[model samples]
Target: STGTMSAEELMKRGKRHLSVALKEECVNKNHVNLNIVLDHLLSKNKEIDDAETLEWCKSIIAGDKTYKEFLEIVKSYNNSSICGLVWTAEYVAYRCRTCGLSPCMSLCMDCFKAADHDGHDFNMFKSQAGGACDCGDESVMDAKGFCPKHSKNKDRSKIEPPKDLLFVAEIMIPRLVVRLVQYLRHSGAEKQYISKMTSFISFLQELSETGDLMQQIFSNVFTSQNDYTTYMISKSDVGVEYDIYEASLKFDTINVNKYFPELADDLIHKTLLDEMFFWVIKSKFPEHLVTFLLSILPNEQYKLAFVEVFVEHYRCMMVELTHSEDKSSVSNSVVHISVQLLSPLKLAIEIVTKFHLIHIMFACLKHIINQARYGNTLNLTSNVMKEHCYWPIVTDFINILAHPPIVQYFLNSTSLVNAWADVISSLQGLNMNRREHDLHVEFETETYYKAFSAELEICSTPLWALLKHLNDSSSKQLTINIVNILVTYLNKWFTENSVGEIEMNPDEMSFHYPLHRYLSLLISNALQQQGMELTDLLPSLEFLEILYLHPLHLLVREFFFFFVFPFNFVVGTYKICYV
Candidate 1:
């Protein structure tokens, strides 16, 4: 507290703010006193999730001190963020050096107000097209664009830089457009500075978001064609050997990492990088040459790390493709370069799904099933069996599917069960074709339902406690969806297993399994794919068993348990009551 404010009021406010931060964080949770204040600031409309948090964090990392402070205690500033915003603006305003402008420059290339007439692409300006140069402020400052000593020639055109005057606005302005957005919502800069920076930041974001600015700034930051080429060469995969061979030829290229420290400083690893890699692989950048180039560098070099993040991301993208409405384009050099790029982009997808990547992988299997059901005679059985990359993709998918967000998005979706049905259908198709041999063990959908009893106790623990809410009567729809999903899955599974039901699904209609056993099996396989034991899942195997088979579960939950699955898992290997 400051001025007339007392310490007692500050402590009270601190307690309230702390609770709100934990519960509502940045989003409005409608907690009366908290909600009202946040609503006035338009906080209720903001998304409450990891993405928003990350974006907020990035703003700070991008050099907005105000944002970084917001991540801490909002009340830390004497009841206002105004001071913090001004501090942030001053810090970013110093970026003129990178923009290749004089210290007094205020005009921005992003805003096109600071455009230099000389042909210097981000280089030192021939004529000082400094701040307000377009408006011709140079003449006002003596028409020479500089003092007599700096004015070498009278004919030389010049722009006037922003005056280094003592003003709050100068210090509060954010240099980048992204930082501006944060300033608007979170920055407490004075009204004048807010309006000015708001307009400037918005203007720049629209123009700088794409075209030359983005291409120039983000070329090496994220995945690019060259990165993808490097990634694929590292994988040593087939069909795209040219990049490796070609890279072997050009081993003498200078290391940009040395000349440009900025390159090394801004180096990042994220899933989005795959976008650039994907582009490169499609275009087919030289892999062999790329690999040879990389060989000269150390293993930990960004040159190599980029490739790892790319490849891991490639696996993720393929799995996500199942959820997409359309198919991706064919591969080429750009695609080739991208395909074998980094391990995986750690951006938003770095976290593992709570549902298990295996479950999602199984869902993809359903996609293949759906594909097979359509009656295309591509001889998929043998072809799929021979695919090496496909298996790892499936395995990785299963692993990630178990990740918290991944699982939440997956299990919550009705499409998940359909995906599983498609997987079964495809399996049935393969078994019928049996051009080679038996593919997988036949577990009827009912067997899966039995195993689902394992999820009952998951609510009792913290690991997956959030899912415990699904057991509440309030979650009737969730219960029904889960029940119907698992039930339908079991039916399809049994059809594929118990009998010679080798034909494909009837139509484009969504899939539904009807057996408790199959649901259990699906869950079992999912956990296995995640390399986890049943006990590792929250709600404990014992609890899920009771919840799945007990009458209480059906009464409280909207979805009725199909049957009683004893502590004994039908799979026998996994003890439902234990691990």
Candidate 2:
């Protein structure tokens, strides 16, 4: 009976069947035609039989939406305030057994309601910890499992990653792993290594029963449940256990540090470290991959090796940029990448201090400032400085130096102080440019001043630390340089606005207060020291008198009794003799 039916009649029957299967409101001709075409294309490509492909196609056709429209819907859903809320134990959450790729994947009530998982296997429970919603994470859940609110059809084949990253991840890392594996095969301890790996895996399995240790390991390995699902899917054929075993064998050897030695003199190790630095710079490696790479370092020696290589890489880049004739050709990405690599190593003071990272940073700052000072247009403050990433590099380095140990290193090193003074001198030269009426110039000037002000604020922490630790033994020149810079800042502020126009906010006034306090403390401490006289206070008193008349006077007066009393008493005696 089917064979006897006309072609047109068969088409009609197919459309009706599709409409019923898709649960359409009505049999619209356009919708039917679209579905037929999609089905034909999918079937011709032999993807119609694939469950996931079919599911995606069904969702697209049922919604009567274009790919772009579906993406827009997904974007809107992602932007929704309640969509990605992490539900805590206080709140009831839903988990779809059929759709969940892992136990960790759960949805908040709002996300659960918004998604279309009716008739599927699901459980509603009070979440134990904070559980992130996995509604739109296509890596973990099926497209068909997605609700109408969020549906995105991605063409994996069309995605193109950066070539450098691709080379590092796909080619470089794999090659290194293979070489390590080959080395392991030649070693006489293959049996022992395999046994140890087996024992380790069994231990992990035992730990998995307790949940906590296994969960932590999983969290370290996979940033999210979606990441776990994606990794499992991609490595399904090769198997994750074998990969882990291989990784363990590669790093388990006693001579592992030989391949990643502290110095970068060895060509192979140098290349590998350089590639790792590239990976860090690009920031293309996921967290799990970063953790895996870090795991290769069995001890502090190996970790220091990695840090040394990165620091050397940064140093070389800075040297080249500073020497370049056309400095503009050098990428500001060097600064950005350096910050990304070094900021995390802030706590690694032993390694950082040993390698003179702060010295390198100051050198880089001086170079950037010098370039800005002598660049074309002579005083193109923002464009030239921004082009070289002056502000970010300096600010980030200051943040890194905020650590106590590094600050101590900075204070102790005369070379670092000289480099800092060089930067300060360059800034002072740049500040000498005549003020321009152009809005752009005015805006840039304000930006530079604000950035400088913020840098001063951050510097106060280190300054105070130096004061407490060294007492009067701290570098007097460094203190004088800092005071001079503060004086310059005050002069600029006063020139910009009158004292009456200044805001009454203590927070606003706090910046000016620091200078007065630091100056007062320095003077007070000097007076307390032997051989210091009232005349030594004259210069400082004159400066303080200027500072005291500003709008910051109120806030300064508040803290005056606590920190500046010694200097205040001297000032009172000086005023009695003079005025």
Q: Candidates' TM-scores?
A: 0.27, 0.35
* Candidate 2: residue pairs that collide: 116-147
lDDT of 2 by residue, 360-413 (tens): 555555545545565412243445454444443454465465444555666555
Q: What is the C-alpha lDDT of each candidate?
A: 0.30, 0.42
1-579 in candidate 1: lDDT tens per residue? 123323233224543343333233223222333223222222213432225333432332222233334324222211210010111111222122233222223222332222333332333232211112211223112222232222334243333322221011111111121132223223222333333333333323332222222222322333344443443333343223334333322323222233222222122223224333332232222232222222211112333445454433343344333332322221122132332221123311432232123343443343333343435322333322223213334433433333344445655666554554344333321211111122443654432332222122111121133243333334444434554555554444444343222422211111121234334543454354434444433344443443344222222221111222432432242223224
- Best by the lDDT measure: 2
Best-performing candidate as measured by TM-score: 2
Q: State in Å the error of residue 364, model 2.
A: 0.8
The 10 consecutive residues of candidate 2 with the worst lDDT sum are 164-173
lDDT of 2 at 364: 58
Residue 566 of candidate 2: its Cα lDDT?
Answer: 57
Score candidate 2 by lDDT: 0.42
All models, RMSD in angstroms? 28.2, 21.2
